[model samples]
Target: MLVELVGQSGRDLDNVSANPARLVNVYAERTTEGERVLKSVLGMDRHTQLDGVFVRAMGRVDGVTYAVCGGHLWRINLHGSANDLGAVDTGRATLCGNNGYVCVQAGTRYFVYDPDADTITEPAAGAFSDIGSVEFFGNYTVITEAGGRRFQWSALADPTDLPGLNFSTADGKDDNLLRGLAMDGRLYLFKQESTELWYNTGEAGADAMARVAGGVWDIGLLSRDMLCQFEGGAFIVGSDNRAHLVSSGGFQPVSIPPVETAIKIDRPQACLTYSDEGHTFCAIIFKDSPAWVYDLSMNEWHERAEGVNLGPWNVAASCKIGKEWAVGRNNGEISILRRTNADGSTPLVREITSRTLRMDGQRTILREFEVFPRQGFSAGTMNLHISRDGGSTWTPPKPKPIGGQGEYGRRVLWRNLGQARAINAKLRWTEPRDICLSTQARIVT
Candidate 1:
């Protein structure tokens, strides 16, 4: 009888003996035939490069895309061109758009960009010296006063108009407010140890918004940029060192043990959400670690790295321009996310490691192992590696041709006269051409 080696799952380093699957640069999805298969992640095609060190934020207003690169704000044209609008504070930025205006908050300065006038203007300084977060809700620009428990809003539809008295304190648990988000017509106030939900009441003054009686979530936000809206809710890195999906139902922990373990080791600096070919992904980026991507469609996790050094994926900000997903990278490059196999001209290294297979501690004779590569693939080689001692070490790679164009009948097979009680297998490939593994390797024991 033949036994399957790999299947649909993410990395589980916490318990490798039980589940040792590791997906890199690929995600698992169910096909129409009800079989799960791994698919390559869409690549980033360079759109434009700006004269700055890195892009800090991106947003769309009045059908135009805007980005903050280094100390300047720029307008990105649909034809992959950029125009420098003006200067702004240099640092991480928060952008929120409403009513043809985009509000920007960066490093103790608050500004608003009006596309119709083609200008960026700093709003009158409010009561706070620093702004923690910005969000649009109920025709108002909401912001949290950094290092404090007070939250404020601007005049209706006017991001430049701020009244000193137009603010309220979130005294829910006496914790300092860290960030805020507007989702489903509700304003979510996030703090260091808890979150409070408030909704618009259409009233005047202090009664303009009311808190949902029982809408307090015990989980707090990990950082200012670690929260983003997805589907109908929000994905947040909580202060408890785990990722959670916050919606009307409540907070649902989404980070598995291995993912959480990575989070605990390296703090996430930013989070971005985007959709590609019917799949939604939430990417968490760290300063010195590889990016961890969560596929909402598959409920699995994967790793995305950039450059020869295998560092973090360079995406720093993202926004939708028309129908395409435009991403701003840490190196001041704006790119369009495409369904290709290469990041611009760089081919991605796709890999998957299967779980450890143990035959109840009984050694068995291994016969042959074969894999079914998707038809119509061209120009690439798949390398297989095996480990007999539960991933403590791996054998030398054995390469097999995936066939050239029009050579779809090629078979990837390996015959061996070996015996082992437990084994782990890994497959890796790097080619610009489209490659897909229709089914994992089948081993006869």
Candidate 2:
């Protein structure tokens, strides 16, 4: 009899006893015939390395990409050449631009960059300080005061002009503002214990923006960096320890139980979103845990890690430069995703662990396990490890060659002579070759 090894969707729940299907560095894609198959994720290749220690944030303005790497602001051209614009603070930064000017809020200071003249200038000292987050809306730059209930806006068409009296307080709830987002013709003020939605009224000064009546939500934001705009809404890791999609309707939960459990354990430090191929992926990065990515197109979740130690996907910020998706790492490197199996020179290890199969305490006889991997790869091997005791321990790896070049009729089969009441299995590979698997795996008793 044939049993399903890989399913149509990825589900890695919190409770292993309930479900143990783990998809790492791979996702389920529906073919033209509506058959679900596993496909390896695109790898990252080095675009350029800056002279800074960490690439904190990235943004694009007027067809130019700018990044805050270490204490300097860089202008990255189309050919992966970085020109140091000037020096800025080194902490986490947020970049937004409008009217040919880019506004950067690094640490507690805000700087405005004009690509036309190649000049970086700090806003008037007393104009703003202690900025928690920044965004551009209605030709104005908006900012939230850290640890306070006030949000301010810049002069019309002038991001560097912030009038002293142009600020308003989001006091619908007695919570402090954590971030400010301008999206879909509205401005969202996220606080520690709630969120308020406001809209532009074309008024002057402090009355230019007004809160929508009955637009307050009980859901609070965890951090300013954990929020990203997706589709027509926004994706955020709420203070409730779960990921949510906040749209015009309200907050909707998007994280699974396993994802929630993982977030609850380590908590996300930052997040970024970018579109590749036909899918939009929001990657949530933690301090000490693997990164979890949400596929908005398929509504599924998967894992992404780098190197042999399987650390968090080393992505600090990401933005699309022209038609290419560019990611900035903490090590001052910028990379672009391509159709390969390695992250530059480092090999990307893909892994998947199957859910435990329990036979009601009835031992099954020896059988053969077979997998159907896409053939015609130049060279590679798929290693399978079996666990008879529900993944408590794994057997030695058994490697099988995928196929040679033009060899499209290869079968990855493993013959075994063992019996078990419960069976668990894992498959892993690390090669700079294309690898894909069908959703079916057969086991004959």
Candidate 3:
């Protein structure tokens, strides 16, 4: 019988019991270039690992980019050159840019970078000190204290002075923890157990900040690094242990059940989030597992594309400088994604693992297998591996031609795949470009 499989979708590794969602290196989508699936976000391999175990923060000021990794700040020049600024002795780094400077907070210490002078130094003696995190709104530099219950902003436009500025949410009520987010003309205070909205009270000079009339109680933010501002509001990890989109209509759940199941709550403090323009998606990463991507256009959840190793790629932090989207790797390397090839110098491997197909308790015989590449992918051969018994083992990989460019609709076939009680498949490619493809199987009962 000719069993025609539909288009392959993005990776759905969490779903081990069903088929229909095509787990692939890229998902199918119609673009201006024609109907094609995603190509794995290309990475800069020649840049290898940086001098740290993981990248903590990324920022750009005056055309110069910086990354906080291994407790030290490093100047990153995407052309493969970097300069370390020394150790910070902090577990995580919080960065915010204002005016012409970028401020960095590590533990109880704070430092500001002057890009014009190429200097990184602590603020003056009378300036604000002992800050845990930093955010800038207008000319005001806002910060939370170490183990403190309130947040404060600089006096006037000076982050180096404190005798005059008086902006804070210190109502002597609760410990309004976490960093502050300035959005839609209000300051959003995220506590460990609740959320508060504060706005300007029209009170001159000093008494400008005041809490909103009614705050969203009960719902609190969980991950500090996972907070992201989208077109509507912000997507964050809520106290309910699920991902939520907090906006004007109040907070609502957006993360699916499988994603919530994979989140490492105990590791909440380490999660990270960023947006991808190439794929039009937002990604929230729980360090211990494969990261989850939310399609901003579709408002649906999917897994990050996988490498040929058949495992999730390790991306710790991401930031956009100019038009390039760069990611900091868990291994301390900083590279750009969404390129046509892998890092230009290193050959990146791409893989696709299909969802489990059930034979309904009947042994199924695979008579033949057929593959189709996108109209543009012409030139390399792809390898195939078949797995039975739920991925316990896979047959030796088989190689098939992917055809050359201009050879659209060309099909490659393999005969006698052997019988199995249950099965799935994996396809890998090393020299593939525009490799959006589909497959079908000829089976016998």
Query: Which structure among the candidates has the greatest TM-score?
Result: 2
Model 2, global lDDT? 0.82
| TM-score (C-alpha) between model 3 and the true structure | 0.81
Question: What's the CA RMSD of model 2 in angstroms?
Answer: 1.8
Which candidate, 2 or 3, would have the higher lDDT against the true structure?
A: 2
Clashes per model (N, Cα, C within 3 A): 0, 0, 8
Candidate 1 on 1-445: residue-level lDDT in tens? 4455565454554666577677777777788988767778888899999998778889887778989998898889889899998898897788888688888878757888887898888877665758877789999898888889888888888888877777888887778988878887799999999998988888754466678888787889887788877778878899899998888748999997877877777767888888988888888888877788888887778887775445778888888877899889988999998877778888777877887877688998777778877755477888888888777688898998877878878778877937899878888887876777754567788
**Ranked by lDDT, top first:** 2, 1, 3
Local distance difference test, each candidate: 0.81, 0.82, 0.64
Residue-level lDDT of model 3, residues 1-445, one tens digit each, is 5444434443334654444244434444446755434445444443435786778887776667778888888888766688886566556667777777777877677777666777777765332356667777656667766555567666556665544356455443465576677777677777777777777665645676777777656776775566766555777887677888777737788876666765643253344444444345556665455456666554655555445443455666666645666778777878766555564454566666666666887787877776666664458888888888766567898998866777766666777888887777777777736565544444444
Which portions of model 1 miss their true places by more than 4 Å? Answer: 7-18
lDDT of 2 at 174: 95
State which candidate, 1 or 3, has the greater lDDT.
1
Worst 10 residues of 1 by lDDT: 1-10
